[model samples]
Target chain A: MNGDDLFSGELENVMRWLSTAGIVFALISAGLIAFFLTRRPGWRMTPPAKWLLLVGFFLLPSTTMLLGNVVGFHRVKTSCAECHVMDPWISDLRDPKSTTLAAKHYQNRWINENPCYTCHTGYGLAGNLEAKWSGLRHVWHYYVAGVPEEIKMKRPLPVKTCLHCHAQAASYLKIEQHVDPEMEPQILSGELSCFECHASPHPRKNR
Target chain B: MSDPSPPEAKPAPAEPRRSILALTIACVLALVGLAVTVLHLAWPSPLMFTLFMVVGQGSFAAAMAVYLAVILVDLRRRKVL
Candidate 1:
């Protein structure tokens, strides 16, 4: 199936319902735990009850996370739009005629589904964890501290993300500029930024 | 004169062992869950992701349930229910 089809009506609806149910379950479980803890009964919880509570507590977050991921996948555009700051970038991506690197990539489907996530997420285990943590921080900033007017990446994008696709590709390797033996060290060491030559994928003007 | 006091009962020997065993199982399960989650995040295929979501989270949930059960049983034994 096409990537877009994954977010189509029926699946999206199912994911939304599941997300809502998971949230309700989590809240109820939390409330029960709170009640159990705060109640003025001298009586201790039985072993079975204690185990149930423990399981319930673990399940609350775990289930919620699973559902959250699924739901987030469906609402990627909407969730990103919540900050309003990403409006220009999203619009550019959706624009077929746009010439920006990111726009070209999106329009051509160079990356797999979820173009934003594909580019933004780092490589490997640590990179993935970092991405998830970064996402959480973004949510925290959006909800609690309020996103800054000029949103910027916390750090420079890693060259590895680019290399993950381009390094071995015949088209990329065929380019003379990419094959400069002298430049290889600089590229690997990150002394030279990829964007310097290629230009910013998402141009500042679009923002 | 004060009446003779009753002797304190000895705790059951089996209880601690059971709790320890349950704790060990929980720890193992939690580690497995964590590993699966990390793997899923790294590779990110649909099947792997689904497996991670189910098995990883399920393991944690099961571990917690086991611990809670142990606590409940202990409470019952103490007549604190």
Candidate 2:
């Protein structure tokens, strides 16, 4: 999507506000920790109280980080949908008239909820981490740097993601298009793109 | 110097060495876990991130297990369980 289409005015404002708030909160937390650490002898806290405060100081940021991860993991789709840029894509998935491969997979619940993440994220542990990392980077760019004019995938969508589900599907394997041994090898090796045949994978408008 | 008074009749080692060892291991595991988690946050690569998550969380679990073992030993020693 074009930069403008990638992020709407409302989304931009919300992101700016969130980022500013995050910075403010971080500063406040650091200041409090510093204040506690630099207290004078006469105003010294009791040993237990001092230890408790020190532990809290150390735990605060880590706790915040963990909370963010947990929230992102569970609410990925909602978080992604917050950016209106994805709205059209999500809507297209739900559009009954749309016959794109993506739309069919999404509408049919073949991949379940968060269909965007399901197809986009790599498979297994490494894939999950990569997706999370990419997501964090996306947030950083959207909030810290101005959103780019063109939003592009970091890499071509991996064939592995497609094969993860379809490889084992009896119906998929039985299909004539997938029956050719040469075609299977080529597709598996990434020599061929799935979209080559599925030309209207996400047709912008229904035909 | 007067003969070292028969080594001062070394006092019996009352504190449970096993408990102390377990607690020390727990603390070490916890610190390593924290370090891994911080690394994951700072410079995340896919492999490192996966390793950190597995090892980091595993360390925390191991620490808890060690602590639990200590508790169980203490309870048994005290005849409370």
Candidate 3:
């Protein structure tokens, strides 16, 4: 179970480091810049000050922000819930009595950490990149174009999203329909979407 | 074209007022970004995350652009480029 808690503790440590060292470094750089501003110009600026401005102020903080966003922020459930549109789905995912596939996984801890991201994001590097790209597009929609009333996937759900795990599982392999030559190609080609058989993963109301 | 006006030697390099201001602004932008990013990391939210993604990263970009312009101008003026 300790290994399962990887998302729980390691993220806290990252947060603590960023809030402490990260904030302090930026503040210190700001103070130094202010101090340098008061001094007479010309050749008064020492090389050290320039290096501090370049590295301490700019380089470190930018890298830290990128790291913070990708590593830890994406793992938390509320990170997605932060957008009001996702509230209904997050609530359903948490509801003990909810019969949704997502809720069952959540209650059972089948995916452990970041069940939302895990299910939504497909497997592998391309999938990860696509997820991040979609994330950016979501922000653009939320702010510039306005969010749609009923959220819908722009494309057919990738069967790989479900198959990456399920394909090897005994429950899935044992099913005659899954291994049937007739059904297998349809599933693989995504002509037959996984959820078509499994039904709704989340309720209709995203809220 | 033969009027003999003296070519005065370059005056003492004046203080880099513009570059200093640029760096100052850069500092402010970066600080605000760092703060918002930290806040979001502490408590997750779409609002804060959006700010972090937009304002926070936006400030960094603005700051970097200013820094770049300042550096280029300074280098050109000094004939170092």
Winner by lDDT: 3
lDDT tens per residue, model 3, A1-207:
454554466766556655555556555655655665566554334576777667756677767577557634454433677677777888998899898888898889998877778877877888876776687678778878999988888877688888888989999999999999999999888888988878578886664
Q: How many residue pairs clash in each candidate?
A: 12, 0, 2
**Candidate maximizing TM-score:** 3
Candidate 2 lDDT tens digits, A58-171: 344345335324432544544565665566677877899888888898778887667777877887899888887787666656556766655657667777778888888998
- Kindly report which residue stretches of model 1 are placed more than 4 angstroms away from their true locations once superposed: A1-78, A205-207, B1-6, B9-81
* TM-score of decoy 3: 0.75
Off by over 4 Å in 2: A1-39, A42-50, A59-64, A147-150, A204-207, B1-81
- After superposition, candidate 3 runs with Cα above 4 Å error: A1-9, A43-48, A70-72, A75-78, A82-87, A94-97, A129-151, A205-207, B1-18, B41-43, B76-80
Q: Across residues B43-72, which tens digit of lDDT does each residue of candidate 3 receive? A: 655556667777887877787788788779
Residue-level lDDT for A129 in candidate 3:
68
**Winner on DockQ (2 vs 3):** 3
Instruction: Score candidate 2 by TM-score against the native.
Output: 0.53
